[model samples]
Target: MACLSKSSTFSKTFGLRNLLNLTHLLKIIHRMFYK
Candidate 1:
C-alpha cells in the first residue's frame, strides 16, 4: 500500500514536469514563428 502511494505521487510529479516542458517548447515554437 505504501509503495503504491509513493509511485502514484512520483507519477504525478513526473507528469507535471512533462507538461511544463511541453509548454516551454510550445512557447519557443510560437516565438520562432512570430519572428
Candidate 2:
C-alpha cells in the first residue's frame, strides 16, 4: 500500500513537470514564429 501511494505521488509530479515543459516549448515556438 505504501509503494502504491509513493508511485502515485511520483506520477503526479512527473505529469506536472511534463505540463510545464510543454508550456515552455509552446512559448518558444510562439516567439520563433512571431519574431
Candidate 3:
C-alpha cells in the first residue's frame, strides 16, 4: 500500500512537470509569433 501511494505521488509530480514544460514551450511560441 505504501509503495502504491509513492508511485501515485511520483506520477502526479511527473505530470505537473510535463504540463509546466508544455506551458513554457507554448509561451515561447506565442512570443515568437507576436514579436
Candidate 4:
C-alpha cells in the first residue's frame, strides 16, 4: 500500500471494484437465465 503511488493505488482499487461489479452482474444474469 505504502509502496504504491496514489494514482496507481486508486486505479488498482478501481479495477477491483470493477471486478466485483462484474461478478455481481454475472450473478444477476445467471439468476435471469435460470428463471
Candidate 5:
C-alpha cells in the first residue's frame, strides 16, 4: 500500500513536470513564429 502511494505521487509529479515542459516548448515555438 505504501509503495503504491509513493508511486502515484511520483507519477503525479512527473506528469506535472512534463506539462510544464510542454508549455514552455509551446511558448518558444510561438515566439519563433511571431518574431
Candidate 6:
C-alpha cells in the first residue's frame, strides 16, 4: 500500500511538471507568431 501511494504521488507531480512545460511552450509559440 505504501509503495502504491508513493508511485501515485510521483506520477501526479510528473504530470504537473509536464503541464507546466506545455504551457511554457505554448507561450513561446504565441510570442513567435506576434513577432
User: What's the CA RMSD for each of the models?
Assistant: 0.4, 0.3, 0.6, 3.2, 0.3, 0.5
Least lDDT summed over 10 consecutive residues: which range in candidate 4? 1-10
Q: For residues 3-33, could you state the per-residue lDDT of candidate 2 as single tens digits?
A: 9999999999999999999999999999999
lDDT of candidate model 5 versus the reference = 1.00
TM-score of each: 0.94, 0.98, 0.87, 0.84, 0.96, 0.93
* Regions more than 4 Å wrong, model 5: none
Off by over 4 Å in 2: none
Among the numbered candidates, top TM-score falls to 2
lDDT (CA) per prediction? 1.00, 1.00, 1.00, 0.94, 1.00, 1.00
Best-to-worst ranking by TM-score:
2, 5, 1, 6, 3, 4
Per-residue lDDT tens digits for candidate 1, residues 1-35, read 99999999999999999999999999999999999
Q: How does residue 10 of candidate 3 score in lDDT?
A: 100
For candidate 4, list the clashing residue pairs, or say none.
none
Per-candidate clash tally = 0, 0, 0, 0, 0, 0
Q: Which stretches of candidate 6 lie over 4 Å from their true place?
A: none
True lDDT of residue 20, candidate 1: 100
> What C-alpha lDDT, on a 0 to 100 scale, does residue 33 get in candidate 5?
100
In the range 1-35, model 5's lDDT, one tens digit per residue, is: 99999999999999999999999999999999999
The residue pairs found clashing in candidate 2 are none
Model 2: ten consecutive residues of lowest lDDT: 26-35
* Cα deviation of 26, candidate 1, in Å: 0.2
Q: After superposition, how far is residue 10 of candidate 4 from its true place, in Å?
A: 0.1
| Model 5 CA lDDT for position 25 | 100
